[model samples]
Target chain A: MAVDKNLPILIVDDYKTMLRIVRNLLKQVGFDNVEEAMDGSSALTKLRESRFGLIISDWNMEPMTGLQLLREVRADAKLAAIPFIMITAESKTENVIAAKEAGVSNYIVKPFNAETLKSKLQSVLGAF
Target chain B: MTPSNVLAEQKLLRQRIDAAHAEAAQPLSREEVGDIVREVLTTMQGDLSAQDLGLYKELESLARYIQHARREIAAIRPADIRDCHLPTAHDELDAVVGATETATFAIFDACDAIGVIAGGIDGEQGVKLTEQITRIFEACNFQDITGQRITKVVKALKHIEAKVDALVAAFGESALGALEADPEPAGDAALLHGPQLPGNAINQDEIDRLLASFD
Candidate 1:
């Protein structure tokens, strides 16, 4: 399918700065219809309340982490099909494997640039 | 005589006196009593002096050790570490996170304003300006990473502060018992050490390679 730049994107992170950065990066990449949640539980609430085409989330968060959020998303039949991308500072092998096992669509390590974000989004959403 | 030898000599003397009393048909005469008194006094003078000297030496060693321990513990100044330095360090790191967050948001504000300014122009210069603003947005992400790193440091400082507070409490039974007690992190979460410091953790390229291997 052709990429839908207008599709709603949900970005979840505990840090305000990271959320802002991801939103700005997404805006730069031509995806301005974005929403944010501070942690996994809130993100899940938002997901249940509304619809999102893609989920870009930080792997680590309080109360519920992104991995836990991914597991929840995968378990829910209603929300399981949405593409999920994990952006995290946890660069350990096990962390990546765990996210993969939990059914992440793509992974982006921290300190990434707009190019990386764009390419990852393209890979997940089809070519822009 | 050594302290042990003195003890042995005194035991022997008691035995001898018992034997004498048991064997005698009559009570000890004056001369006999005087002889026993003289012998007891002579043995006691020598043995007691040696025993006193040995005990004095041991007491002196103990005193020295106590003095040294006192000096070392005093030098730690647990009060200062717990009350002053640790709090200062925590506050300073908190300040750093706050300052960086403020600066990062300010940068964001500037970038947004620049984007607006760039929107008016209709040329490559406008495109270039927008790109530069995006670059600033990406660079501003440093605040998030730095904030996480500072949080880790703050946690370590808290652990250290806990230890100092326990020390200041003089390791009372309750304090000592609680020294090693930290709430156990649940399950896989235990393995999650937060963002590694520079040079300590794997890079993005390595993570990408590992993820590719899975594919």
Candidate 2:
């Protein structure tokens, strides 16, 4: 699936540093219009307010984690169809299972390199 | 000499010899021994003279005092032995461990934020930042998972900080610059505004497609 360059993307994490890093990576992959949120709840708020072409969220966070965000995104009538990808240090089987169950399009383990991220993205987008 | 007188003299001689032997057998006299010790120690201490006999006596006293101190020190147990309560040590260890865990988690959180940001931007700048963040996250995970070395997290954070600063500077120069240059600030301002956009006008399919890349 060809991704639209103009589509706004929302990247969520509690750390501002990670947000900048993810935004830079997405820029490299040919997506320029990007946005950021520090937590799942804020990300959800962003999702509800504007159009995000994609959401890349950290799995662990305060108030609302990535899993909670994924569930929220999937449950909402208008937001349910939005693709949600979980990025986390948790690579446990149970966690992956839970994320899959929560309607995550894909799961990327922490410490993933650029190739791993790109391939994972392709797989999720069915662009691979 | 008379028999009694001879016996007394022999006894006196014997007692003198015994006294000498006893004095010799014992550690030593504080004064005479100090001379000998001073001779040996003076080699280490540089120089000495007979005039320093008073000083030598003082040194002997100090040595005796030190011997007593040595005995006292020997009587006491070592710190680890005296305070061998595992619970308290464990508590202290746990405090260190807890701090380590917190620091590790913070690095992980920072890396997560980097990943999120990398997922949002575009072009060479994005790739570089993404790679840098990925390396940092890898370093952090390696420390936590393999080495269990929490100190590595500090190094990773430092690396992330440099990258973040670079990105922020770039963002200010490019994105902020463009916004400032644009005559129609309204459209650009809307993008700069927080997540909430107007209405449900956003294209879901595009969003889905974009997010799919993370998968």
- The TM-score leader among the candidates is 1
Alpha-carbon shift of residue A45 in model 1 (angstroms): 0.7
Residue A55, candidate 1: alpha-carbon lDDT: 99
The candidate maximizing DockQ is 1
Q: Please write out the lDDT profile of model 1 over residues A6-104, one tens digit for every residue.
A: 999999999999999999889888999999999899999999999999999998789899999999999999999999999999899999999999999
What stretches of model 1 exceed 4 Å from their correct place?
A: B1-67, B171-215
lDDT of 1 at A102: 99
Per prediction, fnat is 0.84, 0.25
What's the CA RMSD of model 1 in angstroms? 21.1
Number of clashing residue pairs, candidate 1? 0
Per-residue lDDT of candidate 1, residues B1-215 (tens digit): 89999999999999999988767734333445556545655666756677665755565566566555644655656666777778877767877788788888888898899899999989999999999998888888788889888889998999998887766665333323433333679999998966444466799999999999999
Candidate number of the best lDDT: 1
